[model samples]
Target: MWENKIRCPCSRCSNNKFLCEDKVTEHILNRGFTGAYTIWSLHGEHDVGQSLRSRDRVEPYASNKEHEEYGEPIYDEEIENPYSRMVKDAMGPEVAFNYGCENESRLQRLYMSCKTAEYMTWHVQNQSDDGVLKHPIDGEEILSRLNSLPDLPFGTKCGDQKISGYGVSHNWVKNSILWDLPYWHMLFIRHNLDVMHIEHNVFENIFNTMMDVKGMTKDNLKARQDLKVSCKRPELELMKNNGKIFKLKAAYTLNKEEIKKICAWVKQMRFPDGFASNISRCINEIDYKFYRMKSHDCHIFLQRLLLIVFHDMVPHSIWDAITGISHFFRDLCTTEILVDHMEALQGKICETICKLEKIFPSGFFDSMEHLPIHLPYEAKFGGPIQYRWMYPFERFLQHLKKKVKNRASVEGSICEAYIIEEISSFSSWYFEPAMRTRLNRMPRNDDGGDVDSQGRLSIFIHFGRAFGPLEKSRFLDEDEFYAAELYVLMNSEEMLPYIKMFDEIIKGDVVHISEDELEKVRDARFVKWFKNYVATRMDEIDPRILEISHGPGRMIMSRPDTPLEPVTTVVVS
Candidate 1:
């Protein structure tokens, strides 16, 4: 009979050391039992079983149990003797504990234990070999060598079948080496060659296919010859200037007669629309006159005409007359002082007109029957004259005296008086203490009425008093005093019959007045006398254009009383 098994006499197995020595020896020899079994058995069966169950659950999910269990200790075993107590002590605790757990566990636990052992053995072997492993070869090299051939020539066949060269082929050409082969055969062959060892012969069939030539063919030679000949033609030719083709030509040719005719045509043209056409004609005339006379004064006059036409005309006439004049003068004259002056005057006039429009109240001039004052004075002095007893009474009395002397003078004198009263009224209104306070509260340069300059105030006063009552004695004659009064009457009555003619000339609507009525109105003594006076002074008020055409006179006085200086002569023999 087999002796009952006994634990080994080592310190770890001492608790179960009751068996025969032969049985223990047999167990160590046959079962490969280690000295740590005794200590492993000290853990209770329930504890060991629970540990094994826990390990069985963990092993399937563990990534690195083998490395954790054996890897580091295995390396330590190489440094220390495997049989030494210090080595066993270090390795035994963990191994014995694992073995106890494994023995009590189920088959699933055993499988994981075996897998861990196998993986640990592999890791150890790899570590021992320093990581260089050999790979096996199959028939890959034969396939590679078979793919290392050049492309076949175009229209060539290998044995009985067609081969592709540059493109896919459906039929075989006789004498081709790569008949019925896919295009990949040539790609593989080219790609497999060593860079330094590749031969020109390898690409000979490809070159032949590209050239559409076969059997030891020359490639691209005809193309190269054509390119060389094309290059030589450019060097052999002479270049000419092509710039003259792009230049613009002159518009028209004009001789002296043609130019003079053009000038006359422009001058004779009628404008019936006031001075617009006349201004343009003058500009053109001045331009032609400049070319004929070569005078700076003619050019200056042309510039002035251009400014007048441009500044005054409406859109319809401006384009036809003014803009045309400006363009013509721009071509002729280099200097333009007259144009500058006209432009400045236009700006000043527009500004003055705007100021007048704002200052004067509407209907200010419609009926100044209570006073004979100018419209400007009505704005500036209307309030002051109404409040002042002396001025308004004097004005009313003057109007009455003028009316009694000549019934025609009544309307004009009363109108002037009314205008003066209104202007005086406006001045007194502006100068009131409340109004002055309001004006002072405004900003320094604000639009409120704060008269800063004494000169400007004087001008305002002058403007206000322009049509106010003056001493009757100051007039040269009663006709002179009633000049404006007669004008008002004539504009209202005598100018009516020629209304259509005036409208045609002025390009405005006409109001009808009979000729007989105009004659009757003109028969008034003051009207007749004023007309004669104006006629006599017309030359003084108007400039004579013809006089300026001649040279200005030089004053020469004879001084016969003084002796003239004698001429000295040098004697040359």
Candidate 2:
């Protein structure tokens, strides 16, 4: 008998005996070789010959020349054979193709058999009432049964087996109660099939049944209301307690007086339990003696004492009372002592100046003209004679000018004349004494070196005259005239001592001269006198300027002595 056959060379194909090589080839050639034929021929049967024929036949129909030139053959082994090469030369290489034929074939058979069997069985089973069925219990009947059940024990397994037993009993009870109802038969079947399961069905049935009994719509609304009521009570209570605690702690930490007042307020308030009474008792026990002191000084002393005592401990409530009390006493005592010392120092200053005025009247007053007028002395001017006590004789002029502005006017021309006479007379007195002091203080060869002491007396005596009252002018006009005369006289060796004094004071820090002061010094006519003195002394002592004037290639030599020419060529070369 010639039977209809379909073949797949795959080893796992269900019907091995049904495969036909002839049919497979005819299918490839007629239907055009699909990927299935290529895959089955090569990988399933290892049938290289069939693949080559398909490859050769399909190549001539290639879409382009490049594909024909290097296209893969249906059976790759054919590339080496003469006949295959000739066939390819005459036509073209076939397209090699692969597809999942084995999987498709197996699935097609399975689907056809399963679908046929399902249809037959479905029809046969549906004809009988008990064969295949659906539950007939409506949502209302299931809800009624659930509501009737007593609440399950908390630890009950609620597994499917237990649920199945309950479901059967529940269905019987439902029918007995609703025997005359039209849907009783339907309800019985539904309770058996829909509600019972072998595992984990009890919890699901209970939940679903409860949902139906309550009605999902009402249950959701009730849940929302319950949550709101639960949340509000705790929130309001929390806020009320927090506000009371916040007020109590804030008053306690910041101001002791405020804390006492607040505690009294709490005691008057109608608080729950003994809360107000307890808080008031706690406040009374705390040490608040320091609270009577002023805040600023108390705070400073408290902070300092705390730093000394508890620098290593992290600060907490335990040390606050002790530190505050200590600070109050410390600030009050220290401030009183400071006030007493200041008063005593003021008294001493007033007595000293009176004695100084009597000892050397002219010498002391003349020294006062150049003293610094600081702010404290400025405020005390004329109000009291106390400044004269603190200031030395040299500072008397500053105190007079600042304190008694009329002192200069009071002394008048006679004072100026007297000052001029006194400055000149005092120069001799001050110069010899200063020179002797310098000489006596000088380092000797036995102590260190003779270099520092050799001309020490002469140098210092010269310096003393240049810096002493002689250098300070009594009036503006006199100062200008004296500076001009001094400049000219300074061009000679006789005036060298004054120049040395000017140099010493200019470089020294005793005067604390700023750049502005130096500029003022430079603008003063006395600077010209000092410069001329320096040049004149250098000329007399060294005689090097005369030598430089006659030196070879000297540019200055080109100028005339009387009417000197401006030497335009600065360098001789």
Candidate 3:
């Protein structure tokens, strides 16, 4: 196939011929190129078959080939700590911090103003005819209202002034940087009730109740049910087979006395692998335990670990409500941002709130902890919940805070370290094979040294960038393969020598990026599938330009699905 494309130097067709597209293909191929890749295999370049990227990356390399590529890193870690390769559990929260820096940037201040405006607007618009707020108040608002003229949030509250039928709990909003921003008057964005804060408050409410902590216990305990009959499980085939009915024991319940006993019990309780030690410590500290527990500790305890704890405790309806809310949030945090999905997520949150209302007395929700109900609309209309999530910024703060090594001049230390990191990160991009990733080293090919899977020096463009003509040359990491496929498709060539030799075909879909082309696809299901398929496969497939066929079934071309990129992976709970 390559030989036929070469222009004949013998001159029979030289002067009349234009030396078309075939000539270039012929020249590159027939020029006696040393082609080790003329043959190929789906089994891959592994000695016994595996990609150069190490398998069992989290544990240890699975075989010699994997060990050759990646074992050194694991070995180095083990040299420092013998158990490094084993699964290690974290004792505390890692994703976010309980507190953030007091200082705010000008941009942050602008966002705060927008937030304040939006919050005030939403409440004003939703206020009832009776002059009461339709929903619960928040901490910031309470702080603002209670503040004196000389206090941080001045003018918001005077001595005994009330707001939305509630008295302020404190006097401090001076830390609210937005109060002085120029755009404060024009802002109309919702005050972002951070999900982390909402979750923390809810957990505290439940925890305080569970321990029957002094001044924190509620008469209408949401999780209490010692005197009532609860829902029963349906009779199953086990009872039918025995020709007898087996009764279930009453569901667990606790009173003030029982809770106090459990609090003592908790001091001696030993949790399994996943729990933090905070659960046990809270036992003796119930009087003011809220002061010790950080937001994330409370968050994890209530959202994930509480379900197991409740099995041995009470059958309070409030506990069920809290569990429902926790489950909804778990879904909210991880769900992909499809419009339909977002709407459904919002619906679920609303339902959870309704359930909360049913379980708790009205006054129980009259605090800022209830502010999260308003967040769903914002999340649905705006984007994925992560876009509004605090964890990323909170996690970054962990990195930023670490940069400060000197106490004498903490700000200077942080600034200098930050500048140094910026310079180093920028300098890294100019290196021979720039590492755009967080990985400290380059990828391994089949060789002992860094290279592409094909054993060539790999030129990776971090997060993709464009260069060269024909558009496809700017790659999604397989330019050569992409170009070859395009060449075969557009050129009317019978088959390329490489293809004929290997008898192989690439096994993935091609997505045309044109909006016009996508609009032709009208089937919602196919569009959704195609989108999700593309989203999930971007890392695996050759992601350059065009040419598409969907096996004649999938594709309705208008729209679809980011964590790097969000799909439907649920939080395991």
Candidate 4:
């Protein structure tokens, strides 16, 4: 197939170009063989496939060429771990952390397979240079530092020395394991901040400081003491009351009554299915402190609920600052990121941080607060925050933790359960779509799966289902019936045409029907007129429209689906 000219397996060429035998030899001598290319699969060497499902398969033979070039592998028996053994003997078999150097050969793994090699250098290959901080490579600080690496030794003390006036240099504590790779310094994003935990930490700091939670809050006696040295705010200054120290309320913090109001609101709040965890579970109405809120809980609070809950409760300046920070996060973590918008976000985040700094005590401005300034830049390159966040990894860790059945052999039990799960997941691919598999499984609140396509209007095709046990059922009264029916007809997309027809009829009767009055009239008469209108077009319209036109049944079933003590789900029969 090659016509005696084989692909050059050099590090630079990476088996990408066909070269004569002499050229191939020359390239290999100049650039070394492509990393981990021992198999020679492209050069007529067959690769042995090993199924993850089977454990009895014979181990593939290691090439003698590899043995000749790299030397024999080091066995555990040859390398002694006296320190580890001594620790095990003293500590009763405690697990010792592995502090080992990065394997030089492992760098090959990134370029070993052609499938992944291209993606490994994607930032370099597909770099955008239109002055947008659209990728890790565009992060000015990191890009410049990485590109203009100092000539000093990787882990030398010289890299840690203090500059003339600036504090001691903390750039390189120790050489990173990644520095073993020749191209490590060239890569734009060597590490990513877990936005999940950063947001969670930032939220905790804000919530704790604002609520004035004892012990947990950043605004404690020490912070107040520091404030005495840091700021000129006399209201927040510490007071000596009969030898007992007291700190006055900062303008940013909620008073006891305000905290109570916010707590009561949260205590009675409810969320839809799959939106967020039970936030009310963490709310303490008595203490006015949220307890046991997880990362995801904080995520929901910071992004969706912070501004709503704090509205009108705090002073305007405080509220505006909180709103700015809250909005910064909401925009930062969205599913789609626009580069142009990200630049605007850069300014917004800086302004938000500045606003926060003006309101919050010095203690509140931790590294996490500073971290947001870099986030928009990271988002420009990294794309959506979801892919880089720890939510999925943390959830998977929880899943792995659940898999441990044997206390004595935690790893073994987890491995066994994991393999079984993988097998089941793999097997599910072949299962019929109608059958329940992980992929086709319905949510707890699924409204009975698409409702039969035939003889159904699009409005009826999609609707919510109440999941909790029914709490109450009552028939609607005259006023309730009028309001309920109007709400249904007004909201239904399928009923929009009938609503327009009714509007025209109203316009014909009343020469000047203002939009506001027309809306009111529509709300008053649309339900009854829609029924008669749908009746006239019953021959052409779907039967569902007629059913909805008559309005929902008076029997309303209210159910509390969430942890919050509120009636969230209403089913009108």
Off by over 4 Å in 4: 1-177, 240-244, 427-436, 439-444, 452-457, 463-472, 475-483, 495-555, 558-568
Clashes of each: 31, 6, 10, 3
Rank by TM-score, descending? 4, 3, 1, 2
Which tens-of-lDDT digit does each residue in 1-573 have in candidate 4?
A: 288788899999998999898898899899999999876777655555556324423222334455567897433355444544534565675566878645543434444444345555554357665655444445454555655655422221212222242334654444557787655775556678889989999999998888888888888877777876888767777899899988887777788898888888887777765788778888876677889999999999998889887887788888888888888888887665678888899999898888887777777777888988998877776666776788898899999999888899999999999999999976766566578878668766556666745766655566554456877688878887777777776777777777788889999999988999998887777776777767787889866766776776878877876423344655666
Candidate with best lDDT? 4
- Give the Cα error of residue 238 in candidate 3, in Å: 46
Which order, best to worst by lDDT?
Answer: 4, 3, 2, 1
> For each candidate, what is the lDDT?
0.34, 0.35, 0.46, 0.74
Q: Which candidate should be chosen as best, given TM-score against the real structure?
A: 4
Listed in order, each prediction's TM-score against the native is 0.13, 0.11, 0.36, 0.60
Query: Model 4, 320: alpha-carbon shift in Å?
Result: 1.6
RMSD of each: 49.0, 49.0, 32.1, 19.1
How do the residues 1-573 of candidate 1 rate in per-residue lDDT, one tens digit apiece?
A: 125544464443454565676655655566565554533443222234767878968865453566677654323343333235534564656542333544224323322433233433332243321111111111123234435545423221112222445244444344445544455343322222221111122122212222223233322234223434443423212234664212111111123454455456545544322222232334335435212221222333344433342232223432233333333334322221232333343344344333322222221112211121121122121111123223345556765565443466766766776677678654543453555443235553233343545432121222210122222222224443354344443443333433333334333322464666544544454344444544666665323211221212232122211111111111111
> Candidate 2 on 412-513: residue-level lDDT in tens?
644665576567654434344345543245533122322434333221222110111212113224444444444444454544565567646675943777
Which regions of candidate 1 are displaced past 4 Å?
1-242, 245-261, 264-573
